[model samples]
Target: MALRITDECINCDVCEPQCPNTAISMGPEHYIIDPDRCTECVGHFDEPQCQVFCPVECIEVDPDHTEDRETLEAKFRRLAVS
Candidate 1:
């Protein structure tokens, strides 16, 4: 599943750089994750790099944009090529 940054974010700015897909970006209030670009680091790492490096632990699975591992992997492949 894609991951999302919640309101609990402290804006420490650690999560943005960790996203391999460049899915995380500055939102109006805090950081936001684009579901289209998010693959939970499927092809890049065992776990989502953003989630792993997030100091506030505000990152979590996006229930509104659910996806399976295979789907994430496919997205990763597409992203890698482009």
Candidate 2:
């Protein structure tokens, strides 16, 4: 599943740089995760880097954009080629 930034985000600026896919960006209020680019760090790490680094634990799985590991891996591979 892709991850999302919640309103609880403190705008700590930690999550943006941690995203290997460059999916996190500053939104109107807090950081937002682009589902199209989010791979949950599958191609880069065993765990999601942004969630690990978010100080407030505001990052969570996006229920509306859920994807299995295989799908995430495919997306990661596609991203790698581009």
Candidate 3:
């Protein structure tokens, strides 16, 4: 599944750059994750780099954009080609 930055995010500028897919960006309030580009770091890393680097622990799975591992892998593959 893709991830979302909750309102709890402190805007510490920690998770944005950690995203391999460039899915994370500064939103009006805090960092937001684009589900279209998010693969939970499936093809890029063993774990989600954004989650790894986020100190506030505000990032969480996006319930509104849930996806399976295989789907994430496919997205990752597609992203790699572009």
What's the best-to-worst order under lDDT?
2, 3, 1
* Model 1: pairs clashing at backbone N, Cα or C within 3 Å: none
Best prediction by lDDT: 2
Model 3 regions more than 4 Å off:
none
Worst 10 residues of 1 by lDDT: 47-56
Q: Write the per-residue lDDT of candidate 1 for residues 51-71, one digit (tens) a residue.
A: 888888999998999998889
Best by TM-score: 2
* lDDT by residue (tens digit), candidate 2, 1-82: 9999999999989999999999999999999999999999998998999999988999999999989999999999999998
- Per-prediction RMSD in angstroms? 0.7, 0.5, 0.7
Q: How many residue pairs clash per model?
A: 0, 0, 0
Candidate 1 scores a C-alpha RMSD against the true structure in Å of: 0.7
- Predict model 1's lDDT versus the native: 0.91
In terms of TM-score, how similar is model 3 to the real structure? 0.96
